[model samples]
Target chain A: MTLEAGTTLPTQTFVVRRADLVRYAGASGDLNPIHWSDRVAMAVGLPGVIAHGMYTLALAARAVATWTDDAEVLELGAKFTAPVVVPDDDTGVSVEVAGEVASVEDGRATLRLTVTSEGQKVLGMPKAVVRA
Target chain B: MPVDASLVGRTYPPTRPYPVSEAKVRELAATTGADWDGGPVPPTFPILLAFEAMNAFLEAEGVELARIVHGDQKFRYERPLRVGDVLTAALTVASVRSIGGNDVIGTTSEVRDADGALVCATSATLVHRGGAA
Candidate 1:
């Protein structure tokens, strides 16, 4: 089925954990203490160590991919708005997605996405172009 | 102990070709909660291949991975990558400088296809924390 422009895809909700942050730090060659150590993070300028912006955006892309059954993601762009604080509580960090198909034709779809936390948009202008 | 300035402007030999795959792309897409439209590959996918190139460079330079930080990354693409494409990525030390007892290293990578056609250019800033003591 061809996705028409303005068609809203399924929303995805997930959390970020200290373990996942550490693993991403290793895999991506990013080891800033602010990403893994809450004490260090608080010592710096954050409430606590937060997930990498790319990591969070990566999950957002998964939302679009799952909707279309693993179609090719042509391009994606995002900007980090706020730190995803990893609290001591095991609840971790929650990410919610609200997006719609911006355009679609010939097995291709462009999605405009917004990611929020507690009514505040943390990731603004989330966009992706994909093809199946 | 700053990163060797002599490495600047030096272009390393291209690393072994890495093949792009559908399954890998799907995995990345799954991780991002993205929907693929069956079009071109995601822009960030090549970073997976580039990471290998970066690792080889670090190994050759004797740089410790634990001490490095990815300060920034930017990708400029001419076209999308497709599955089954055998691509080569060559890393070059573009610039370097010392900052507050640390070393900031800049690197550029050019990715090309088996036919030697340029596909994309990536620039990254690596902060060598505490290397310039």
Candidate 2:
């Protein structure tokens, strides 16, 4: 697919709840308490059970992968700016992801991702380079 | 607990070769909500290997894993990795600095194939909170 500079990709939304976090913990091998145990999270001075930063990263990556249609050949990066505090409610939090084609250079397109949760930006300076 | 400046630039030994499995990939995809579109392994899958190396680095340096928070992450792939590729990863402490009573550690882990060809590299910033008080 040909990507033009200044192209804005379709925005995607991902829902992350407690069960999803548990599954991700098992899959990713990151059994951090802050991601699962509210008591531990509180002890550690966190608001509550927060999703793993990597989990959030994974969500953003899915959007990029879906956009590029070739998740296999891409370089993705993100900065964890703010925590996505996941309350223990049945309805978890939703992360909205939108991307812009920052540039198309040398057969590679760099996408800048804006990831937000609860009306606040959760990731900063997120970027992905896809060989299209 | 500051990451000793001397630890910077130190590369650990290559990890045990891990053969990526399709079943594992499917499990990861199901859990992470990734579409099982039968493409290359997810770009974030290297974390399995990177985290292993990271635990080794922390243990060798006497850093408590419980006190650390992941600050950021990035992955650069020479090419996409696929299932059945036997891979190994070598980790290096790329940089380290302290800010506001916390230690920020920068790490880069090189994932290589059985033939030592580069596959993907993962870089992460770990923040070690200074104290409990």
Candidate 3:
């Protein structure tokens, strides 16, 4: 079954955890206090430690990878307009992705992915280019 | 508050080459939940290359690092990045402005392969969280 352009994939849910957030901070060398320090993040006006925008963007990329059998996920990008504040209560943040195949040709496809949390778009205007 | 708008249109030299390793890409993939064995680098992987160039340019300008927060980032690609791809990234200060106790800086970066073919173009916005409103 070949994935065609404009084909929308089912939404998958993911829990965004503080521990994962910390790992991302370390991996990306973006040790923003707001990503791990609940107290500091709160002091800075966030409800709690928020997941980095890139983390959410990564989830969108994951969807493309899964859809394309781990094909090259080229040029995924977005604007971080809002912070995803993860509360300390242990109910990790949830992200859902709905992807549309924008174009397909010669074993390569472009997917327009929309990632959301609590009904709000997390990775705004996300897109990916995948091979096969 | 004043922004050094003269910095706009200034193109910094290409940054030092960063060897793209599978291990680093795997780690980033795991962190972002992208497939580690995607056979090619994950999307957003170019950010590291672009950010490094941005960092050097900012340091050369004496910009206070501690005061800046990443606001937004976007990337467009001509093709996917693969292992063994040696690339050079250059940054240009696109715009700067003072906004409510912060300095909003915009920058653009172009990444090219060893063959001088454009691989990716990235744009970013950072908010310098200093100064009084």
Candidate 4:
């Protein structure tokens, strides 16, 4: 696939339930209670149990992998601009990821990503560079 | 308590070598709703090592896990991680500042292979919420 500049990749949405966070906590070894315990989250001034920022960022990487057929990622980064407050319901919340190829040069494609939860941007300057 | 600004530039000891296994990669990929077919591991997989290094840094500094929130993260890779690559992470305090009663601490962790070759360099910004005094 020729990812030319200004190319828009297909948008992908991923559900982030509490169970997923628990699994992510175990998988990533981040065992921080703020991701699972609502009481601790509130005591720490959070809205409630929040998803791990790396978990959300992982979803973003999953999207990129789908777009590039799992191309080797040269760089990936983002800022946690907002919390993805996950509810106790089974449905949980959804995080939407959209990307546009900003440039394609030097055998690498730079993708500018927009990641959101509940219609609010959750990552500041989320971006990735992958082998084209 | 605010994180000491003097902690900047401090480098923590490298973590013990962590063996990368296919099952571990599959576990991490499964959490993100992806099936690992034994291909390249997920880009964010190195967080396993980085978080370990960060936890040691926080523990030695007496920082509470609940009071800290992730603020930012970045990863630059020398190569994609493969199964059987035993790795270690050494963390360095990159920067520290206060904002709205929160200590925003910047840290960089170098993930290296068994040969001590850098595989990926990941950076994180942790926001520590100040407790009620």
Q: lDDT scores for all predictions? A: 0.71, 0.85, 0.77, 0.94
Which candidate would rank higher by TM-score, 1 or 2? 2
- Docking quality of model 1: it rates as incorrect
Top candidate (TM-score): 4
Cα lDDT of candidate 3 equals 0.77
lDDT of 4 by residue, A1-132 (tens): 677899999899999899999999998999999999999898888899999999999999999999998899999999999999999999999999999999999999999999999999999999999999
- What are the per-residue Cα lDDT tens digits for candidate 3 across B1-133? 3347788899999988767788888998888665576476777778788778867876787765444567878887887787878888999989998877677889999988888898899888887766432
All DockQ scores: 0.19, 0.73, 0.53, 0.95
The true-versus-predicted C-alpha distance at residue A88 of model 1, in Å, is 7.3
Candidate 2's DockQ is: 0.73
Compare the candidates by lDDT and give the number of the best one. 4
Residue A56 lDDT, candidate 4, scale 0-100 = 92
Off by over 4 Å in 4: none
Per-residue CA lDDT of model 1 for B18-97, tens digit only, reads 78777666655544444455555656766765666777777788876545655555555657788888999999999889
lDDT of 4 by residue, B86-112 (tens): 999999999999988889999999999
How high is the lDDT of residue B15 in model 1? 79
> Once model 1 is optimally superposed onto the true structure by TM-score, how far is the C-alpha of residue B22 displaced, in angstroms?
1.7
Per-candidate chain B TM: 0.91, 0.92, 0.90, 0.97
Which digits, one per residue and each the tens of the lDDT, describe model 1 over residues A3-97? Answer: 77878877888776677777666655556677788776665446767777667766776677567665666556666666677666677777888
**Cα miss at A123, model 3 (Å)?**
2.7
TM-score of 3: 0.83
